[model samples]
Target: MNYDQLMFNINAYKENNQILDLAKFLVYEFELDHPNLEGFGFRDELEKNSILLTANGDIGERQMVLIPRNLFDFEFNLVINMIAHEMLHVRQKSPEMMLEDKNEREWQAYYEMLFHTNFPNVPDVSDYHKKFFAEKALEYYRRMGEGSELQAKYADQKLKVLSLIDNIQHNQA
Candidate 1:
């Protein structure tokens, strides 16, 4: 999609009091297909810095993306990227799955958040943010070295994350 067109459309949604529509549009545009993908809306109680998509841990519950009520405080692009990050979490769940490694989940989510083409604008991923991601990447790397089949399977992603970390560390701004 064209960056200018996307931004203009998002702004229109923002002005029309249809931010939830914007979120739904993003979910569809991102092609986040899941039977449990309920819908998107705001939550007053959600913390300011977080946009979360939650899966129902119990039966009969549903999955939904909860945006902060103070949505106007965040940049539209960043907010979309954050929602995409949470939706990535939504896509990771299963009906009866084992607890997955937190580092692995986070690294994968972060990779998609920063690199996905559906998001035309990438907000500044701060040095602090990179450090946090680097720790997760290193832990995943450690798991790979220890012969974790699951981690080993993501070796290509591991290398990419480490390469990004290396590039950023050496070329500090």
Candidate 2:
């Protein structure tokens, strides 16, 4: 099948202009300096029926997001969060320096993703995102007990997630 044919709901999945604009804004906002950066889409190879796969972006070779087809089943907030997370990784791997630590890389990505999630003006954030962050915090907390370095790095993110959860709760209350 062709690349477009592999995408779930290809006919209905009209790419949102606002999300694309947000992606561009994020590149500028995060100072990624990627002029050739295109917007998000599902690639033929990345499709896996209904299974949710991690959304990824090309950083070094090209600048564009390649989202998993099944991820479209989730809310736009998660998709946007994943985009932000991947963009943060692109930012982390700048030419001048390399961010080699996995935990650290994830921490930075999660930080930016949470930032977008928490920002009041950002649209499309919903309860689904709140639940996701809560689960993410629990995940980090579990990882923290494994090692001192993990504890140091992941603990901070757990706190960040808690804060985001708190904000979500506070807003609801």
Candidate 3:
């Protein structure tokens, strides 16, 4: 996919949907010039049964976003979010820069993902996405084995997130 056009379309969609800081975060992740310097594209073949949304090559060689041929089949929010999620992977500087533990890495990444998606107004993260992300957070926490520090910390965080979601869902009644 053409990075500019794809990002443009996603930006337009994001603007209409909600104000997200993801665009700003994207610029911050790169030095401005280096991000759009290489080729970015979609995958050639995908089975209808597959669950893959995106993939990429080394950040050095090129970054590929493998989207299903029927990209338009999904909702615009989900599609844009999926692309933003893939972009996060590309933004990682190096394998060595990654966190030592797999669970923590995903937890942090997803937290950042929810941050960008839910809270765009710097210093203010709305509950607009709390419900959606809380569910995801719960899933991630569940994946970690019992008695893990990561699990305990995230369990508390999930309760707070879910409580916020409940308050919002109940209209604070």
Task: List the global CA lDDT of all models.
Answer: 0.63, 0.52, 0.51
Whole-model alpha-carbon lDDT for candidate 2? 0.52
RMSD values for the candidates in order, in angstroms, are 4.4, 8.2, 8.0
lDDT of 3 by residue, 42-89 (tens): 465466543244435553444455555555444444445555555555
When summed lDDT is taken over every stretch of 10 residues in candidate 1, the lowest stretch is 52-61
Segments in model 2 whose C-alpha atoms lie over 4 Å from true places: 1-41, 45-64, 68-75, 117-124, 137-147, 153-157, 166-173
Candidate 2 contains a number of clashing pairs equal to: 0
Which lDDT tens digits does candidate 1 get at residues 1-173?
A: 77788778777887888877877776666565456567776666467675444433333334676776556557665565667666666665544432366556566677775456434444545665665655655665575447777677777776777787777888885
Report the alpha-carbon TM-score of model 1 versus the true structure: 0.66
On TM-score, the leading prediction is 1
User: Which should have the higher TM-score, number 1 or number 3?
Assistant: 1
Model 2 per-residue lDDT tens digits across residues 104-154:
666555555556533333334466565565665466456546667667655
